[model samples]
Target chain A: MKNRIVILGVLLALGFSAQAQKYFTRDARVQFNSDTPVEKIEAVNKSGTSVLDTQTGRMDWKVLIKNFLFEKALMQEHFNENYMESTKYPNATFKGSITNLQDVNFAKDGTYKVTAKGAMTIHGVEQEITVPGTLTVGGGAVKVKADFVVKPADYKIDIPGVVRDNIAKEIAVTIDASLKPMGK
Target chain B: MLKKIVLFLAVAGVIGAGIGYYMFNKKVPSMASEKSEVTIEAAQLYQEFEADEAAASAKYVGKIVAVSGTVLEASALEDGTPKVLLDTGSDFGVSCEFDPNTKHAKTTFTPGEKLTLKGECAGINLDVQLARCVVVQ
Candidate 1:
């Protein structure tokens, strides 16, 4: 009787895990480029965090403002202080899900076009956004790639008139991350 | 006298613009040359952040902090950026990303090895993150 109960417990645990597979990564590379006729600025943050639930299609992402590194130190300083206000609003986050979760099978190995709708909060302002991206599932890992444009004014990221020409109206952002199965 | 006054003002304006341009284009200073403002144990730093993140961020974030601990993991990103995790007696620890701008003397770290590193505190995300870290003895 004891042996039967132990076996049942093991089976139950396996079934639970197989049904609700989760993917996670702490080292997501998030890059953004702003190009204008007068100047071009780019920065990359390597410590972006993301979590995905395959069963529910729920996902969450967060990146620290202070982590973004720019080639020029002065630009970084101005971005954190004058624009992003790292001391006050330290993080940018996305909370949402893949709208068409059933379209692509997570068990399959292929590149699937997916649309994610979420609320992105930046500089302490929240905005609803829909993002289109490619999700490649293979070799027990998933690679997520997305390209999107963000308007600073929409998020209340004020750009002073003095440097208006130096910054782009729409900033191009790229997200590339490989998420591994939870618990190795 | 009017001609001389205008010429003097022009020279001063040109000098001011030159200095502004130089400062604007200046690169981030090397971490090796920077001094750590706060020196603490890795476990303590993590504990403080876990206790009160806002308080810890106000005290340590953006400051060059030196933390000493046993290395839990040493790894590199896809772009070859080195990162080290210090053990904090919990699930998470203090994470330090080696300075890409400053050449490091030793990048490879074995688990359980005691080390001290200093970098600007970039705030906590699961682990207390330190950016542009350099080995400090």
Candidate 2:
């Protein structure tokens, strides 16, 4: 009986530890740039959340639209109020899983290509996209970097003809994130 | 008559230039600075809070300051507490939690708006890993 109880306790502890292993970052930054006479605009989402599941190779990210910043304050306002309509559609989320999960060994230091395919919702439109990126695992940490293009129309973001050329039809997005162990 | 036409053209050009200047250079009236205020970059403020929430809270508590950043996420807590994430291009963000009873809390800001927030710095949340925030934007 004593041995059986000890085994049960060990199993419970393992389960708890596994649950705690899930890593997340709320400070993920996604930036986009367009070159028109070399004018650069940038925005950051401070409340972005990226979650990774080691056991299942699943990852998820969510961000709010009103969080993007442009050097010109007017541009920023128009983005949220007119372009993104963030008040109506406040949040964007990506639900995807890493395909090369098995290739990553978090305990070792190496770089691996990670393929994430999932539904991304922006501007109240959801589309399926596959994002391929590099993931570096080392020092008990994971870092991811990827760059991809997203069509505004694909996500139902309608830009009026008057300013259509001001914004790109296809916006290039870049993501570079690093994640540390959740707890000591 | 040709001279009159040229005069009208010149007047129209002047009017057009004036309109263009107003649109491009005129600052919004409501944006006028009310008082001398300290402006801190969003990234620096976020790092300060992340490095030590308690210490940051003590240093900035009850001080009126302005921070500018991109809105990362905004949502209501389980108990209907409104919260916003301010990202400064870093891995950690400052979470602004507003009082439910505040008038502005009913409706003001939303996600994705680059905002300059002026507020009294509250404490940080150790459990949720967030910098406790109030709103003065």
What digit string (tens of lDDT, one per residue) describes model 2 on residues A19-112? 6667776556677875454345566544466877777777888775655544554776677778788656756788998887888887788998
Q: Write candidate 1's Cα lDDT for A1-184 as tens digits.
A: 9999999999998767754488988888899999988998999998888888888788899998999988889999999999999899999999999999998798999999999999999999999999999899999988999999999999899999999999999999999999999766
TM-score of chain A of each: 0.89, 0.85
How do the residues B1-137 of candidate 2 rate in per-residue lDDT, one tens digit apiece?
Answer: 99999999999999999987667544322221333145676678767767785576556543455677777767764345456677767645656654322345443456678766554343332212222244444
Segments in model 1 whose C-alpha atoms lie over 4 Å from true places: A1-20, B1-8
Tell me each candidate's TM-score.
Answer: 0.91, 0.61
Residue pairs whose backbone atoms clash in candidate 1:
none
Q: Which ten-residue region of model 2 chain A has the weakest summed lDDT?
A: A38-47
| Stretches > 4 Å off in candidate 2 | A1-18, A36-40, B1-137
DockQ of each: 0.68, 0.07
